[model samples]
Target chain A: QKEVEQDPGPLSVPEGAIVSLNCTYSNSAFQYFMWYRQYSRKGPELLMYTYSSGNKEDGRFTAQVDKSSKYISLFIRDSQPSDSATYLCACKINTGTASKLTFGTGTRLQVTL
Target chain B: SAVISQKPSRDICQRGTSLTIQCQVDSQVTMMFWYRQQPGQSLTLIATANQGSEATYESGFVIDKFPISRPNLTFSTLTVSNMSPEDSSIYLCSVDGGSDTQYFGPGTRLTVL
Candidate 1:
């Protein structure tokens, strides 16, 4: 099984709505979690990062991690049309050296007016 | 966050040909990596590029097919050799941002026909 699993969602929502994206993992060794936003034809940009299990809020985006369940989530509040993009969740087993990221199959979100 | 840039943002190459994608970072970093994202799939790590050493590739990825170069701390390159239609994918270069965080560049979209 893949280390990380996420719904390949082409989820459509209207503007000003709340968008929720999630992912699950099987690796209990994973200690670092992150959320990335990718636009069409562009690479992913880091949006939120969390260590271990906790909730982190940045602007309108909130990232939550539950290590016990190996589940993570990202919530976008008051979504806008420009917020439409692919959201990826990545996990890493925090080693001293460069930690390789294991990513999920990204959820595609479209916020329409 | 480290600013990363990639050359030849998008390319259409013929099967059996090769394409080299360059990645440059705004600042020096010791940890750099290469990844591949196939259509509708998660990002898969290709290799880890460490300056002054040969790149370490992940499982299923080989140096012969995707040779990587890390000449210095701030620059790296990934070359897809003898490309085929199955090799068509988005290639990304990322640098570790400490604490398990990575910053990705504007990916190189490759289409091999």
Candidate 2:
């Protein structure tokens, strides 16, 4: 089984709607969770990051992690057309000299007017 | 967040040829990573580059197919050798930004024809 699993969603939503993206991992050693946004033909940009199991809010984006369940989520409030992109969930160990990131198949989100 | 840039943002190369993508960071970092993202797939790590040593590649990736160079803390390069259509993908370089975060460069989109 893959260490991380995410729904490859081409989820479509109208403007002003709420969006939820999620991922699950089997690695218990993962302590840092992150979400990234990538537009077409662009690189992945770090969107939200949380340490261990907890919730973190940044602007309209909120990230939640449940270590007990090995699951994480990103919530977007009042989604806009500009929010349309691929969202990737990534996890890694918190401490290491050379830490590597494990990524999940991204969820494609489209917010229409 | 560290600012990262990549050269030859998009390129079309003939099969059996080679292409080298360069990555430059705004600040020095201890470790750098190379990743490949094929169409509709998750980002897969190719290798980890540590300055002053040979790159450590992940399984299914090899030194001959994807040779990496980390001459210094702020710069690295990944060369896709003897390219094939299967090698066509977006190549990205990332720097560890401390605290479980990684900053990515604008990816190099490669197309093998």
Candidate 3:
């Protein structure tokens, strides 16, 4: 099984709606969770990251992690057309070195007017 | 956050040909990573490059196929040797940001025809 699993969603929503993207993992050693936004033909941009199993808020986005359940979530409030993109969730373990990240199949979100 | 740039933002190469993608960071960093993002798939780590040391590749990746050079802390290069249609993917480089975060560079999109 893949260490991280996310829905490959082409989820479409209206502007000003609330969007929630999620991912699940099976690795208990994962110590950090991150959310990345990737536009077409562009690189993944780190939106937010959280180490503890709680919610971290930045602007209109919120990242939540539940270590016990191995679940991660990103919530976007008042989604806009400019917010249309693929969202990727990544998990990492503290390996005392440059640790690699395990990424999930991104969820593609489109916010329409 | 580190500002990263990649050379040859997009390329079209013939099968069996090789292409080297260069990654440059605004500041010096300790760890640099190479990843492959296939169509509609998640990102898979190719290798980790550390200055003054041999690159450590992940499972299913080999130095002969994706050789990496880390001549300095701010620059690295990854060469895809003898490319094939299956090798067509977006190649990205990332830097290890302290506190378990990573910053990715604008990816190099390669199409092997």
Candidate 4:
């Protein structure tokens, strides 16, 4: 099984709607969880990052992690057209050196007007 | 966040040819990473480049295929050797931001025809 699993969603939603993107990981050693946003033909940008099994809120975006279940989520409030992008969930273990990240398949979100 | 830039933002190359993507960061960093994002797929780590050391590649990646050069802390290059259609993907470079975060470059989109 892949280390991280996410729905490859082209989820369409209306503006002002709430969007929830999630991923499940299989590695218990993963100590950090991150969410990245990628636009068309662009690189992935770090959106939210969480270290513990709790919710971390930054403005309109919230990242939640459940270490027990190895589940992570990113919630976007008042979604806008500009929020249309692919959301990727990444997990990382604390290797002594520079650690590599394990990414999910990414869920594509399109917020329409 | 570290400002990162990549050269040859987009390119088309023939099969069996090679393309080297350059990554430059605004500040000196300890760890640099190379990743590949194929169409409709998630980002997969290719290797980790550390200055003054041989690059450490992940499983399924080899130095012969994706050779990396980290001559300095602020710059790195990844060459896709003997490219094929399967090598057609967006290559991205990322820096390790303290506190378990990573900042990504704009990415080089390569199409092997």
Candidate 5:
């Protein structure tokens, strides 16, 4: 099985709607969780980051992590057309020596007027 | 967040040719990573480039296919050898400054045909 799994969703939403993006991981050693937003033909930008199992809120976006369930989520309020992009979940682990990041298949979101 | 500059932002090259993408960071970092993002897919790590040593590649990637060079802390290069149509993707470089949080480059869009 892959280390991280995410739904490949081409989710379409209307403006002002709420959007939820999620990912699940099989590794228990993951400690740092992150969500990235990527527009077409550009690099992925960091959206939200969380350490361990907790919830972090940044403006209109919120990130939640469940270490017991090995799941993480990103919630966006009042979605806009500018919010249309691919959302990716990534996990980082430091094995006490070296650290690396593993990312999931991105979820595509489109907010229409 | 560190500013990253990548050369040859977008290029269309013939198959069997090689393309070297350069990544430069504003600040020196301990570890740098190379990633590949195919069309409509999430990013996949190619290798970890550390100065004064050979690059460490991931499971499905190899040194010959994606040769990496980290001559210094602020600069790195990833060369796609004998590019194929399957190699056409957006290549990104990242740096982790001991905080476990990574910042990405603008990315090099390679279109192999």
Candidate 6:
């Protein structure tokens, strides 16, 4: 099984609506979690970051991590058309040495007007 | 966040040819990584490029297939050798000094047709 699993969602929602995206993992050793946004032809942009299991809020975006369930979430309030992109959840595992970030299958989001 | 600049933003290469993608960071970092994102798939780690040392490849990835070079702390290169149609994908480079928070580069979109 893959270390991280995320839905490749063509999740469509209307503008001004709230959006919730999630990912689940099997590795209990993961210590850090992050959410990245990517445009059609650009790189993945860092949106939110959380270490351990907690909730971190930045602007209209919130990131939640549940270490007990190995689940992570990204919530966006008041979505916009420009918000349409791919959302990627990454987990970092520090094996007492160099750390590596394991990524999940990105979820494609489309916000309509 | 670091400003990461990648060269040859997009390329169309012929099968059996090799292309080297370059990533440059404005700030020096100790951790550099190379990843491949196939169509509709999650990002798969190719290798970790450590300055002044041979890159460490992940399972199912080899140095021969995707040779990586990190001659310094601010720059790294990943070469896709003997490319095939299956090799066409977006190749991304990321870096993080010690924070689990990683910053990604504007990926190089490669088309092997």
What interface RMSD do all candidates show, one decimal each?
0.8, 1.0, 0.8, 0.9, 1.4, 1.0
Off by over 4 Å in 5: none
* C-alpha lDDT of all candidate models, in order: 0.94, 0.93, 0.96, 0.94, 0.89, 0.91
lDDT of 4 by residue, B9-106 (tens): 99999999989999999999999999999887779999999999999999999999999999999999999999999999999999999889999998
- Per-model TM-score, in order, reads 0.97, 0.97, 0.98, 0.98, 0.95, 0.96
Candidate 1 local lDDT, residue A13? 100
Q: After superposition, how far is residue A93 of candidate 1 from its true place, in Å?
A: 0.5
Q: Of the pair 1 and 6, which is ahead by DockQ?
A: 1
lDDT of 3 at B41: 90
* lDDT, model 6, position A63: 97
Residue A113 of model 5: what lDDT?
100
DockQ of each: 0.89, 0.82, 0.88, 0.81, 0.68, 0.80
Error of 1 at B95 (Å): 0.5
- lDDT per residue as tens, model 4, A14-110: 9999999999999999999999999888888999888999999999999999999999999999999999999999999988787789999899999
Ordered by TM-score, highest first, the candidates read 3, 4, 1, 2, 6, 5
Off by over 4 Å in 3: none
lDDT for model 3, please: 0.96
Report the lDDT tens digits of candidate 3 across residue range B26-99: 99999999999998899999999999999999999999999999999999999999999999999999999888
lDDT of 5 by residue, A1-113 (tens): 88999998999999999999999999988899989998877888888788868889998999999999999999999999999999999998876445677999899999999
- Tell me the tens digit of each residue's lDDT in model 2 across B1-113: 99999998999999999999999999999889999999878899999999999999999999999999999999999999999999989999999898778989989999999
List, residue by residue over A18-111, the lDDT tens digit for candidate 1: 9999999999989889999999988899999998578899999999999888999999999999999999999998778668999999999999
List, in order, the clash count of every candidate structure.
0, 0, 0, 0, 0, 0
Winner by lDDT between candidate 5 and candidate 4: 4
Clash pairs of candidate 6?
none
What's the true lDDT of residue B67 in model 2? 92
Which stretches in model 4 have alpha-carbon errors above 4 Å? Answer: none
Q: Please tell me how candidate 4 rates in CAPRI terms.
A: high
Among the candidates, what TM-score does chain A have in each? Answer: 0.97, 0.97, 0.98, 0.98, 0.95, 0.95
